[model samples]
Target: MSLPLPRDLARALAFFLAPLLLAPLALAQQSGAASPPPPAQGATKPLPVFEIPQSGVEFQTGDTWGQNGQTFRLYGIQSCIRGTTFTNPAGAKLDCGEASIAYLAALIRDTKPRCTAVAQTASPPLIYTVCAAHVGANTLDLGTVMVTQGFAFAATDANGKPVNLQYAVAEGEAQKAKRGLWIARDLPHPTAILNKALRDAERAQ
Candidate 1:
């Protein structure tokens, strides 16, 4: 019954109504009534959550563990290797490596230990981490404890310098107390022992 709108008039009306048509959608978004779209395919994945075992942990060495098919090495500490023997101040033969592992295991017993990755090595696929073990009201830094207890040495860089000064201090304290490896009259540094072992292996090869 109404006459057809003029073409120019019809176009003008549509232009004016465009924003009005979209107003509800805008309001819905602003009011949190609409959800965001899912991420696009091939998006980067989120990082995995860190987890620790409920039961106490056991170490393959004072500073390393193999879990879930991955090798983890403790940061800022190094321990003697199995078959590495030294003499105690009491003139007794001591298997330093075994003793280190035993000491670490004892610390982990009945304690919930958790570790966060701090570094990684590619040559041997090792993850270096700082781990904390809860004991009563105190939280123990496992790596620092190892050095302080003289079961392990402060780790060193390729230039044979201490990796961390805090660990160095811990080692110094252990030395002063004449604990574990430090009890030896002629204490052999772990780095020197490791280097010598490497050289010997190369010569044998």
Candidate 2:
């Protein structure tokens, strides 16, 4: 003879057994291991276009290429800010910023440049990236080229460390040749100019 279960005990037993009883049914309904949903029907993928959007900048498709694009800042290079001028070797005031922009545009003409993001900046929403700009069968590091040609300066990281040692070396070479901004004897570094600007803005506030 078996004893009958109490009303509360019977309810508790049902609750515990419900999931165990339904689990096999759920498994049987599934064909195999679960799989990701397929891509939407008739959805066309966006192709990457390699074009300079602005001075000293380029962008390409990111991991989510079709959904969102990524902008890349040429790593380890700083072009002069607009309206800034420096005396050249010929003692003429030159707009270094504009020259840097033009040089970068010419260097990347008609080539598909691909970049790898190495770091990110928050204030300006920029990604620091190293890019290989291809010209025919030759490839060039855009940042290194800019520094070596004296069109830009070797930039520093957020922590104040040099962004790239190679870029520093290239900058030294450019300086030795008295190329670009290095022609001036007492001209301040671009970074110093930028820092002074920031300090002035803060003092005004």
Q: For candidate 1, lDDT tens digit of each residue in 1-205?
A: 3344444233222222232333333334335865522212343332122545644444666667666766666666777665557887668887776777888777666565777664343434555567787878999887888898888887655455666667889998999998877888766565676544445545666
Error of 2 at 33 (Å): 34
Candidate 2 local lDDT, 135-162, one digit each (tens): 6799988777778878777665333445
My TM-score estimates for the predictions, one after another, are: 0.66, 0.57
Off by over 4 Å in 1: 1-58, 89-91, 186-188, 197-205
Best by lDDT: 1
lDDT of each: 0.61, 0.52
Q: What is the lDDT of candidate 2?
A: 0.52
Determine the C-alpha RMSD for candidate 2 after optimal superposition of all C-alphas: 23.0
Which portions of model 2 show Cα errors greater than 4 Å?
Answer: 1-71, 89-91, 110-112, 121-123, 157-160, 184-188, 199-205
- lDDT (0-100) at residue 109 of candidate 2? 59
Candidate closest to the true structure, highest TM-score: 1
